[model samples]
Target chain A: MSADADTKSVTEVRPGATPAGPPVGARQDSFAARLRRDWPLLVMAMPMLVLVTAFWWVPALGNVIAFQDYNPFSGGILGSPIIGFTNFAQLFGDPQFIRAVVNTLGITAFQLVFYFPVPIALALLLNSVVSGRLRAFIQGVVYLPYFFSWVLVVAIFQQMFGGAGLIAQILRDHGHSGIDWMTNSDTFILLVTAETVWKDAGWGAIVFLAALSTIDQNLYEAAAVDGARRWRRMWHITLPGLRPVIVLLLILRLGDALNVGFEQFMLQRGAVGSKVSEVFDTFVYWSGLRTGDFGYGAAAGLFKGLVGLALILVANRVAHALGERGVYSRS
Target chain B: MSTTKVSGLAPWEEPGSLAGRIGKGGVLALIVLAVLLPLYTIVLTSLSSAGTVNRVGGLVLVPDGITFDAYRQIFSDSVVSRAVLVSTGVTVVGTAVSLGVSVLGAYALSRPGTLFHRPILFCVLLMFVFFPGLIPTYLMVASLGLKDTYWSLILPSAVSAFNVVVLRAFFMNIPRELLDSARIDGAGEFRILWRIVLPLSKAVTAVIGLLYAVGYWNAWFNAMLYIDDTRMWPLALVLRSYVVDSNPLPTATVGVNGFGHVAPPTLAIKMAIVAIAVLPALVIYPFVQRHFTKGVIIGAIKG
Candidate 1:
């Protein structure tokens, strides 16, 4: 489908040029010849390149500040003294840093167990439904929440589950003591996981649906001819068909385990007091930014980066062994 | 190999299987309900007036009355209106700037064997894997003297590694044959990219552009971290304070009051502010969502 689009674009734009070669000798003058021939294209692309490089690349170099003492007023990264392991040392010593690591790992584990299989299960359920219109409507409803910002999701949950929230009001009306679902430390893991599943499950289902479409319809007919049971067919056919895709997505998820949503944790940290809600990103923000400890934050950031990189490498290898199309390498 | 199992099945054979059908139906219904109930409450609460909301102690299954007053306050309120404008300006302009840069860089990177291509590409990949800490980023933005400037919000996030990768993939999919054909016709690389590449890549470009726009629109962390001037504040930050933080009213902390202390938050106005903050993405998503699921430009070409 996309190949056709690329072909069409090629045909439309570069007309009237050397349908055989750039008039030859255009090789030496390839730079100028190319520019003149493709001025319109160059014109379209130049500004965007310059802008991106200046803004993103220039500031990206700032990552170097992570290694420096980083006094903003005195000078920039080059001028600041490099502090080496001191930042890393301080970070390891901080109890909050340790807690953040535990919390991050804990959340990743919980999500792996509880939220990972949700979209797969939901996709199967959706695919099994007989009504097309109902399927589309449900898909639409489920996908809407994915577009909402973490802020809005947090607000919605608070409005519904907080002290003065809808659920509490209902419990009060029924003359039953309302549960403090929002503020309770024990409920944090469940609450966070539920929110993630609610927002992403449907969106995540799209990949599964794509994979499902490749299933052969004739296989179903053949099974039916043999009078195979529905449950048996599902277990044998549907589950096996989705195995490659499921493995691929699982690998990707594992690669991202070290990095959860930073905004989500930051938004709720004040309420939960960071004791339970603190994650690696938020800890970096608080200790590094708020407290002006540049080295510590960078060290923490480096730790996450290393872990994430290792996971991606291992996950990709696993996927390759399973004969799946992992993230980067196709073969 | 001799004990292989059959994997096909027909629905009618199980038509009378009550347990199978009922279990499937029950699971479907439960999922549908679980997803829809919270959304229903938000829509209902947003529509209901404060009086209706308080009277019910929260949203009812069915709203008694609908009001655009929340939306009205969002547009009419001074604080909200300014924030909304800032967000709009940033998203529109920022997306354009980002798309412009990303497309060019991606095109350059997509041309394999170019000078320094591998190193540059590796650098971009490294960017995705690891990031320098926030403090360093903050100091960079601060030392660069971008503090409190609107540019602070737009520039730091301007070059997204993900978008570049997607665009690069998209460009790579353009058959070498086509570029060769263009070169044979005496067209330059830039010409081929603009005339041939840009138009055909619309869907991916649209998706990437929208992704950039939405990211910029919903972004608050950048503004929170670098932008200190309230005049430069975007709507996401305002939404964070008003809607997410639950201030009784939409308030600006910039430009001190007579007492020179922080202002009190108003709840009713806060709800309206939330509505306004989300309005742009809501208005724009339906228009571009079709392009969004195009797989981040990862896949083999059909040719």
Candidate 2:
């Protein structure tokens, strides 16, 4: 479908713009001619290109400061003294930084196990609801939190599960000592995963639901006619049909492995303590921006970006190796 | 998939055993309640009067009485009211700027064979893989002297690559004949877009606009990093400080002794703040929800 979208009808505009030629040859129009013809289009595209370059590309290039003993107020990014591999060496040696990495990976892994299947289950559950009105109402209720900011989400959690929250208040009423479920450092991973599930599971199910709708219902009919039971039909037809989408989303998730999200961790850092709540992002925020250690922080940030890029590439490659269309196909 | 059953169950689908049906209904009820109950507490507690709040000693699980006093106090407070204005202003202006830039860019990219189209689109797609670093993004915004400015909240994060991609996809689906036929009528690309494309694409456009608006409304991290001045803060940042930080909101603390009026309890005041933060999403969701699901499906569109 998108392939059709990218085909150029503009080449058909110019009398000499040979539609018969290869796409490469057809666009061999002189720069000045092309400029005169396409300046409006370029003008339209300019703002986006300029802003993205300024905001995204420039800062990305500026990660070179990761290698420097950079002081922004003094030398700026340019004049900073170039130090070789020192920041990275220090980053590796820092126990806190190591912990942040481990914590980030741990959260990602835990969520993949415990939090990932929730949306799929939600989609199946919602799918089985006999009434469309009931299904839509439930979907409307559940997807509400996806729009909430992490602060709002954390606030809700605090009001529900914090030291003086509903859960604790009820526990106290039941003659049990109050439990501050939100601040339990021992199960920080589980706490985060639960919050993630609450915030995202319903919204995530939308994609699975979409996939389910697109599945051939006739397959189910055939399976039923062939004497496949409900569970057997679902296992054979429903899951297999959802497989491509499931794989694509899984690959995308792997690409985002390093990000356990920033704001959720940052907000909770003080409450849970840095030992438990600090992830790569909070580490950068505190060590780099907050403390003015730009070079050291830049190093951590660079490490994360590079590793994330590597992970996505590797994950995409693995997906391609499997017989699936993953995020982008080899073709 | 069949809808032939009297109970809305499909013919091929099993109704399940009695216990199974009960279990499913109960689970669905719990899931629905999990969302509704917390929301109910926050909203109800916000409405609970000072006397009711004091008696509950917590979130008023059930409202003894309803009052707008908490909201009245919140709006009366300079800090929160100004922050509300800031958040609204930012959401409006930021969503506009983002929509304008993204729509224009996506239109440009939608048509193939534009000069540098491939390169520009590649740059955008590259953003999905490589993000700007935290410190560097901060430094860039700071060095640009946007620190403490409202544009700091809007510009650095204005144009979403995903939105652009979605818009471009939707634009491409407008049958080529329509745009070409318009071209034959001497319509410029912008005119064609303004007249033909946008008119045909309202649902997706609104959906994208909604995404951008919600993003602007929910964003606090940028305000946190850039607008160090507390007075310039948006509602989301104010929410983080007053609600999440659990710092006593000025209104509840300042009470009759200072402001010469009874204030609702802090817990009620806090829930009111949360209610303020959340109300927009709740109000806006139902209106656009029909489009929202379609938008999500579109977002999952692959090249």
lDDT of each: 0.69, 0.82
**Model 1 lDDT per residue over B1-303, tens place:** 000112222344445378877987787778778766765666666667878867776655676888876666556556667777898899889998888878887887665433334445555555654555566567667867888888888887888877877787887777778877887898776777799989879988887887788788888899888876665678878777766666533343443233212444333444455555556666876766656445331322111
Least lDDT summed over 10 consecutive residues: which range in candidate 2 chain A? Answer: A1-10
CA error at residue A227 for candidate 2, angstroms? 1.2
List the TM values for chain B, per candidate: 0.83, 0.91
- lDDT by residue (A1-331, candidate 2, tens digit) is 1121112333333333545322222266777877776778888888999899889998999999999999877878889999989999999999999999999988888889999899999999988787877888998989888999899989999989999899888888788999887788987777788889899999999888888887877788788879998789879988988888888888889889999989999989988899989899999999998889999999999999999888877777677678666464311
Measured on C-alpha atoms, candidate 2 has an lDDT of: 0.82
> Candidate 1, which CAPRI tier?
acceptable
In candidate 2, which residue ranges exceed 4 Å CA deviation?
Answer: A1-28, A329-331, B1-7, B249-265
Give the per-residue lDDT of model 2 (tens digit) for B1-303.
223322675576656889988999999999999988999999999999879877776778876979999888777767788889999999999999999999999888885555676667767777877777998888888888999999999999998878888888788778877977887898887898899999988888888898899999999999989986777889998888777876654344434334323432387778898999998999988988888666657655533
